[model samples]
Target: MKKTDVDVVVLGTGNAALCAAIAAKEQGASVCMLERAPKSKRGGNSYFTDGAIRCAYGRFQDLRAVLPDLDEEQIQQISMPDYGEEAFMADLLRLTDGQTDQKLANQLVSRSFDTIQWMMKQGVQFTVNENQYYEKDGKRQFWGGLPLKTKNKGVGLVQALFQRAEALGIDIKYDAKTTALKQEDQLKKLIVEIAGEPVEITANAVIFACGGFEANANMRKTHLGNEWEKAVVRGTAFNTGEGLTLALKAGAVRYGQWDGCHAHTTDYHAPKTGDFNKPGDIYKKSSYPLGLIVNVKGERFVDEGADFRNYTYAKYGKETLKQPEQKAFQLFDAQVSPNLRKEYHLPEATCYKADSVEELAEKMDVCPESLANTIRAYNQAVQPGPYNPAIKDGKCTKGVCPPKSNWALTFEKAPFYAFPVTCGITFTFGGIHVSPESEILGDDKRPIAGLFAAGEMVGGLFYHNYPGGSGLMAGAVFGRLAGEQAATFCNRTKPLSSKS
Candidate 1:
């Protein structure tokens, strides 16, 4: 077995792990990153995302700090409302039904802007999220609280982080899976398997940012219920909960909603696992808020317009999985087709277009009569009001069983469209508990020396549902926290020259 020593060892090469590595290096600690996948498959679930990040901002000047490239002309063309810390916190509490851990939520909300600035300084570029905005009265009015995304989405984020890590002289070992962890007198030992060979790495501190078990079928069935076994994985195949298992063995206490996960409505024909070649959220169909969704039986199962897509999309996948065939169809008319997101226009999407609802239903394999009746009933229930997608306008349904709370427009146009969708699990909400400083906590609620955690592996901040863009933001915020605390621990516990 090969042996090595470092001041800090970070598990996983995702956004959180890379941030932790960079923060530790900035703190003057010798850092090394261990990736479970090969170099070609690096950047865990973070690489599969759209790179949207939520943060608190008081004004346009606050955004200018992170997006320094934005000029006066570009800023004048966009409209972004101020999202303060209170609004961010309220959104989390409302989405989670007040079950989110207050301490962790507060830390994430308060430190979000600073973390975004830090990421910008580390070479990550930001751009205005054009998709979150709508052309109203000539100006692009951003609706959702989230208004920023990485320049080229997740690929850009991971590449920039990797480049920054390389520039900082951070050591990264791909194909190195840390399977076990042991506590020594003043150091932690990690047993890693590299290319089928065993290697031992002893470090003064360790940060676990390896992510959740969304990709593990057995774990999904056991924790998220049996239905999740058939759900598609929307992210990396390497997040199998090994980090959680190792932490549990080290006496860390489990926390958060083990049965809850961040799932979304993805194309029915999307691959079981995310496609590396077609990365970046291309398979997601989030335009349901602008239309209606029905099961194969041609009946509505959820309130399509309960809130903005940001708050409702994460949990709708579970509802889709509960359908008879674990599938659903999103229905739209020509009046709203132009308002659909870019994902709807992808060549690979499973879409059906017809001149009438009956023809559309026939193409989707749904009962034509049932679908037509359902659409007729929905159209009659829509009340006359000014329709607006930028805000929760009072446009709604009156007598519908499951009412459309906003953007209720009658589907009385020429061409009708339907999109086949299925559940795509993003990440698990269950994970180990950690302190505000990102120190891993034991079963007795005590910090474990020389051990810390970040990212999806550190839970209690999310519950039943999630706010879009907050997951990546939480990862960056906590990853930096974990790294700073881990580096400080190393400085206090052992000398730089000490080795096993």
Candidate 2:
């Protein structure tokens, strides 16, 4: 049996948790961070992230002098076009159906730049680039997304944050799981858990920075649906949604539960054989456009040939629920093979070559006769169809764009490749309810005593869709807010009488 005490107890050693600990310690609070996974890998999901905390608004006006490549106008475009207090509020309302806590959402987005600069002051590396046509004004900006390329200094920005957290003397505990809530007088108190034996830690605040549930199959099935449960766990392996479940069990409300893990096309089976091939993540250029995406009944759904700004795999997930199996196909002709094989090696790309469409359909596991007939009709389309008369229209699941727009290959060009694609989830958008000051809000809409929450556990923080890399950005921003707010809360108010 062992016991420890601190002003704040943070769960997880990931970026969110680490950032919270770093911020808390800097704010003159004794901080301790816990990790449920192995410390060697730095808690999977966050460690492998593309590592750029996407922050919009306010360009680095002075940096342009040294880096001539990035200009002021180009930087502005990279940020979300609809940025403001109103945009933040509206986004939460639209996505959460007016259930989001508007105050907290505004706080997180407003303080994003401060969090970024704080990380920089702590010796974190970053790159400044002008994202031409990325958003409004094309203003020059910093590399909030590309952390690995910073002056060739580090592998990831979050990785550098981890190093900085360690240097700041924040207690980093690995393989520690917070199992129960230590409630005093019906108010949330310190986190209680057992590592190897009996252990308890006393703290004025506990932050659930542990990631959302995208890895645990049962949790995924329960939340997303039975079929989607089998989806390949794409986020961090350590993110099994412990905070989500634990908070709910403790009467915590939820937000952004509907916002799911989204992805586009990535061929797992076919990889390039060159020395320059690199593993991809949220940043890599997708190997789409080279394939014709089709729905279950051997039908073209979207326009299939358009720019995919936010085209995600979640679109397909919605369709898979209505179809026989969670499935979709990318059809490509010989002309596309070189671009895919030579340029971007698609994983698990299946090649089907036959004299007739029916034979190719048979090899692809699609409706052999139905697919053949559909192809024949499509080839003869006079009025032009996603233009076939047969087969039910495709289930254009995730994208807001036309499906067939990105899908080409008329099947008139024989010898095709059909790669099966899936809609896998990554991180969950739902989280613990809070106010901007990192104060946890109860059902009564008041602060939950001295308790607080931020990071992935932030409920009602996001309005509608995520604004690019705002997840990590918000984590750093709000985590800092929580630490400082909690510190101020403790400073202004006298210590409680042995409650927690």
Candidate 3:
């Protein structure tokens, strides 16, 4: 019903979209952002995350540049290892099993720390992650790779970006869903739904950063195979693939793994869609690395300790989906019970406790006989070694199928706990193909003029899995690039003003 024009229009309001808008505005382009969610739930997948962004750092000083609040005591308390761009690249390629695009991976790693510093200039604040690391014998140690996160978690991350964008005069429209896109020569048009009514927006250039199609059950069942509809959506319900779909309709090339996604071990009782009230990844159950996980048949399906939790957690949910009835349970003994993440303690969490393995299985409705045999075999196979949670201790099972390759310990301690778990789809890896400059390419493998993409919507950076904390990093890196490029494109081609 209403028509408006801007120099640049950014789709979505998460980290990627916000970064794109900020960069475009800095380039002297009048920017407007379109968000599908309501004002109260504006942030997309970025709001549901822990706000961890993997960055390449050469020393403590490099970290201090972004996290200025690191006191001498806090610095002395932790072991800060130098994580270079080479290490970051290796991690990306290794986690994705060499399926990540080399160019995209290079850009993500090289720009990671610098992007965080740039975000700091834009009022985004970060701190060393306490959740991913631990303190032992007065020496704090980092685990699951290099770590940095927003000071107030996901909420703070988005709020900081929002503050910067607002300060820069970016117009953001919430409850505006982009339904269709049309090209009128040099100008790009977007038809959006606002309060159940259609409104047309025209822009010189567009940056698509809305995210993937993880929330669409139909898309999931189609691309991700059968029973994927049962996977719990771990982020915004609004990211149902319109961005990727409309872009493809307008000649964007589809790339990356059509069946691949990033998932997490979420509580089995989590809602079908992400709970807006529980905004900060509270539904995730990350304690499986310190324990054993089994299906309803009481059998370990995958190696729980194949790698650090950061690398393995993203793919474990898929293995969970393949289990019987798409359900599994994590069992932890009293010795390692206190080491679980903060989410396990939430009042809404579904957990059962018992003094024995059979009792625990009974409470969780698992086969008691099979669970007892599995536990007995696991305990018998655990070879003794120095148990270090900060690194791969190689305390492993000697003769078990799908052995616990690290942090292996007997489950003989009393007061055992079991938590039911299911797959929580974070974001799909199938997305639009883009050039090194973040320009979305068409099926002919050429960049489409006046169009760019960032975040999860621009795939080829991941495949079957991804390393934890890297999602936000990739989002920031490509978001900045796409924004800068879109701004340049818009300036090169002047479109008619809406006021005309």
Candidate 4:
């Protein structure tokens, strides 16, 4: 077996791992990153995202710090309300039903803006999130407390991070899977498999930022229930719980909601696993809030207008999976068709359009009569009010079982459309416990020396539901924390000059 030594070893090459490697390198530590996937598929789940990151920005100065190109002319073109730290914290706690780990939640919310700034300093570019905004009165109005994204989504984010990593001379090894972790004396030893060969890597400190077990069918069945085994994976297929398993073997304790995950409505025909060719959340169908969703039985399962898509989308997939055939249809009329998200307009989208609701139902393989009745009931129940998608207009539905609480527009128009969708699990919420400083804790509730965790590997920040764009924010914040803490530990235990 080939043997190597490094001051820091980072597992996984996603946003978190890359951030960890970069921060460690900036701290004057010799850093090495090990990616489970091949070089062609390097970025893990981060590459498949839309790159939207949620953070607290109470003023334009905060946004300017991250989006340096924002000028007075651009600021005048959009309506971006301030997102305060209190609002961000409230959203986190509200989505998790107050089950989130208070310490981790506070850490994530407080350090979010600073972390975004740090990422910008590390060569990542930012742009306003156009998807979160709706054009009204000749101005784009941003809602949902999220307004930032990478320039070209996840692809751009990974490219920028990789460029920074290369510029820093950080060693990155693709196709290198860390299978086991061992603590010997004052160093951490990792058993890694590279090109079918075993290699021994010893590091002063190790950070696991790989991900969760969202892509593993067996693990999904075991943890997230049998229904999840059939759930489509919305991200990388390489996250099979190896990192968590290895960490547990090293005596790390498990934490968070093991049976919960960040699942959402995706096109029914989307690839079982994410398609690298069609990256950046192209398969997602988040416009249901602009319309209604019903199962094959033509029964509405959830209140599509219960809240903004950002808050409700993550938990709706489980409802879809509970339906027969684990599929549902999102229905929209000509009145709101133009307001639908760009994902709905994709040529590859599983869309059924017709002149009438009955025809649309027939095309969607649903009971035509049942669907027509459901639509009729919904239309009659819609309370008369000014329709507005920019905010919660409270244009609700009356006499409906699952009432549309906002953006209620009667479906009395031609060209009705329906989109078939299913559950697409993004990442699991459960993982090993870690301190606010990103140090992994053992079964005895003490930090394990030289072992830290970040990204999806460090859970307890999420529970039943998730706020959109917060996942990447948490990854960057915790990844940077883990990297700095690991580097400080490395320097404290072993002098950099002594390592060869």
TM-score of each prediction = 0.99, 0.72, 0.98, 0.98
How well does candidate 1 score on lDDT at residue 118? Answer: 92
Q: C-alpha displacement of 72 in model 3, angstroms?
A: 0.7
- Model 1 residue 241 CA deviation in Å: 0.7
lDDT of 2 by residue, 1-500 (tens): 47666667777766667677778778777677778765654544555444434543433453333234555564544332323445444443554456556666666666765666677676666554222122213432222122112222223655677778778888877777777776564233444444555476766666777877767778767766677666655445677888777766665676655445443333323221101123224222234444556666787654444432222333443443344565666666665555452223433334456666677677767788777665555544423325211112232323323334333444556566666655545566666677777777777767766676767777665433444455667777877777777666555543232335
Q: State each model's CA lDDT, in order.
A: 0.91, 0.55, 0.89, 0.92
Predicted candidate 4 versus true structure: per-residue lDDT over 1-500, tens digit per residue: 99988999999999999999999989989999999899999899999999999999887566877787788888788887889899999999999999999999999999999999899999899999889989889888989998999989999999999999999999999889887788989788889999779999889998999999999999999998998888999999999999999889988999999999999999999999988988999999999999999999999989999999999989998899999999999998899999888899998798888998878888988899999899889989999888889999999999998999999899879898999999999999999999999999988889999999999998899999999999999999999999999989988998433655
Off by over 4 Å in 4: 495-497
Least accurate stretch of 10 residues (summed lDDT) in model 2? 271-280
Clashes in model 1: which pairs?
none
List candidate 2 segments past 4 Å from native: 58-101, 127-155, 185-195, 249-251, 256-291, 302-307, 311-314, 317-323, 332-363, 367-417, 461-467, 493-500
Model 2 residue 91 distance off true place after TM-score fit, in angstroms: 7.1
lDDT by residue for model 3 (405-452), tens: 999999999999999999999999999999978999988888888999
Prediction 3 TM-score vs. true: 0.98
lDDT of 2 at 266: 35
User: Which residue pairs come into collision in candidate 3?
Assistant: none
